[model samples]
Target: MSLTKEQLLDYYRKMRNIREFEETIHRENTTGEIPGFLHLYCGEEANAVGVCAHLSDDDYIASNHRGHGHCVAKGSDPRLMVMELYGRAEGLCGGKGGSMHIADLDRGSLGANGIVGAGAPLATGAALTQKVKGRDNVSVCFFGDGASNEGYVFEAMNLAVILKLPVIFYCENNGVGEGTGVDYAVGADSIADRAAAFGMPAKKIDGTDFFSVYDAMEEVVAHCRAGNGPYFVEAETVRFYGHFEGDPQKYRLKEEIDNAKLHRDCLKKFRSRVIEEGLATTEEFDSIDSDLVAAYKGYVAEAKQAAWPRPEALTEDVYITY
Candidate 1:
């Protein structure tokens, strides 16, 4: 279905939010204000926000190491996220998780996993619980193409199907898996096809297009929510940053990155579509841009001044009732 005016505005806002948030992390990390290796999701904004638009607080999502976008889209607090990146005690997970493990259970975000394909099982388990309880809630597992090759992901899929768990296996195919393209690792051209082999519903969509991803996800999510079992969606996307903060990205060609930026930019495409449909005015978008600039600047300033995590927290949140 074509997006309405409100949906269009929401899509634009989310894509822009992800872009701005990632860009902020990039700038701060480069200046040595934020600690640890950070992978910015500057270029793949739509894939996260679009797929997540159909979800709710009752629903769940599992994220990859590059998970800030998913966290924000799933309704995480921006201030806490920034504090987490800053390794402050007020940060999410009490600054114990850092960039790779930021999570808020209250918001239904199942924490970004450090090991590839690790989140699939967690999401599947969540879905299983929801299913046993007869809840309509669904779980979405956000993994990269690289994670698609993991044995755990495969096992999770089979288990979810056997239990008829309402889970969506979301594959963000950003062309490369930390330098090696999916083509080099995955034998199939379509990740969705692989999901079908496991006897589940599957489809592929242009991850760079917000409306396309949103519409497609609505269908898949609906099917899953109706107790039709698990589904798979492969989003064709691209990341502008290196595997982490400081890697040289020598495996990729400069020309390829530039080309993706020009043709496959999700934010640019969202702007064009909204403008072309006359559903939103350029002035409206410009207003959002202005607000974003101020918001990001404010977040960075506050984060830089926030207190760092205390050494005593090293043993906290590791185990319950230990």
Candidate 2:
């Protein structure tokens, strides 16, 4: 609410970009243009944008398989991301790391990991570096409800609390964790409760609402930057798509998916709030949406025409010499 009109519009633009980018990937994947496994970040836009909005380039974040949104919100070039997915040499990773592994260190993205629960320790280590060097920058580890059950996640939480590191253990609890319901898999009452058991401050919010996520993260980021140690946040969101592109999603009921898409869409909620508050007009939002569609089309076309990495370059950047 304290955000200016421009800030609200920027939020809408970022969320729309993520939605368009993911939807475009979904379409291109079916056509065999994008390579490898892609876990689309269709409905989880607010969580990434809201959190990263409070962060600076000095801060760090590690992400899960569904990471395009995080990369975009963190300021990675979508053109480079598209190129990466297409396996072009011009990609952020030189085409070696595909959809699941895109990283932009310059943007403070530690890269998206294919292995579940891998980002926890990575972010924790980054936070430790900040503390050691007496920097105020914090680190955030974006994991899902599925990754919450991993041992290393809990390990990272405990270490963070013990060291009082500036890190946030963010759980994007989208109800279902890759076909396994969180109810059946998560032993605790909730992911936040499980994290609270680690002696860190914890809370859960509606991830679909950008304001809710942004406000909660504002306080959390401030707390960490002030040297109050780690915090835990579980954003209960919904993914409009399946676990992966082409996933049958038989584990989810049709009505459940439909209800979430209609009632809990983050972009819709954001637009309504901004418009009702007289902060932005529908025409403004529509302009952003239209511009993104055309821009993404261009990204795809350029990526398709980009060159592949040379074979000799494969052994390059794979190691460091003394």
Candidate 3:
């Protein structure tokens, strides 16, 4: 790996932060502390961290509903994020936008969208702006295996390729699109093949492996930054959680879930790799995790204590009455 020990450890902490934050919210949602529905990004940490590691704060990323990991990977404050989940006044979107729509434009996070495949166009637009303005900054569009089949996604890809925009189509193909399998929805033999048809650099990677995801993304990000056109990456990841917090998941096999947790967990794979490479120790990673637990604990607690958005502010950012 070209990454330093310090860099690998930093990635570890970022993944841990996402895992802990999602698990915490999963528990808190049951007690009603976290408002609104959620699509937890429990097992897709590597996909987000790997790609975002190559992006700057000036580079934009558009995310889907399962977006906490993306936001954390891109440097959104965990405290404000937790507050957003709680619909507090000080949240990321001033509490109006919950889990599905957390935007931090200053951080270049376009937002966690509710509409599937919508972020692709937004990222495309960001990339177009960069290209037109002669900026080297690239934009990343993180979507799911399901959204990969969306018409808007293909449209965005076509535009991006034709315009030679600096955008990366990062598809977290978790095999399951909500409840239906990817094979059912995506007519293409492989989702990445869609990009292949467009003559874009398409890679199908093992998303459970941090190094694998990171390395692939590093090359793509580098290429895009060098003024190359858009690329497509299909990361074969696993979603440890169901479609939603309360999803019965009748479609999922318990054994598959167990197998994924045991053998395909990104955190486990990452920890093993780092330790084997002599880059870090188990105790060292655990220490970082301890701090993460405390930080998330504080974030959730502070969010609980935060005030709600004022009633008068409800219509404040809605429209133009003049």
Instruction: Please give, for residues 1-322, the per-residue lDDT of candidate 2 as tens digits.
Output: 7899988889889999999999999999999877689898988999999999999988999999999999999999999999999998999999999989988889899999999999999999999999999999999999999999999898999999999999999999999889999999988888899876799999899999999999999999999999999999999999999999999999989999899989999999999989998989999999999999999999999998999999887889867973
For candidate 2, the per-residue lDDT at 114 reads 94
Clashes of each: 0, 0, 0
Report the Cα lDDT for residue 163, model 1: 89
Global local distance difference test of model 3: 0.92
lDDT of each: 0.88, 0.94, 0.92
Q: So what's the TM-score on candidate 1?
A: 0.97
Off by over 4 Å in 2: none
- Estimated TM-score per prediction? 0.97, 0.99, 0.98
- Candidate 3 residue pairs in backbone clash: none
- Model 3 alpha-carbon drift over 4 Å, by segment: 319-321
Worst 10 residues of 1 by lDDT: 1-10
Q: Find the 10 residues in a row with the least total lDDT in model 3.
A: 313-322
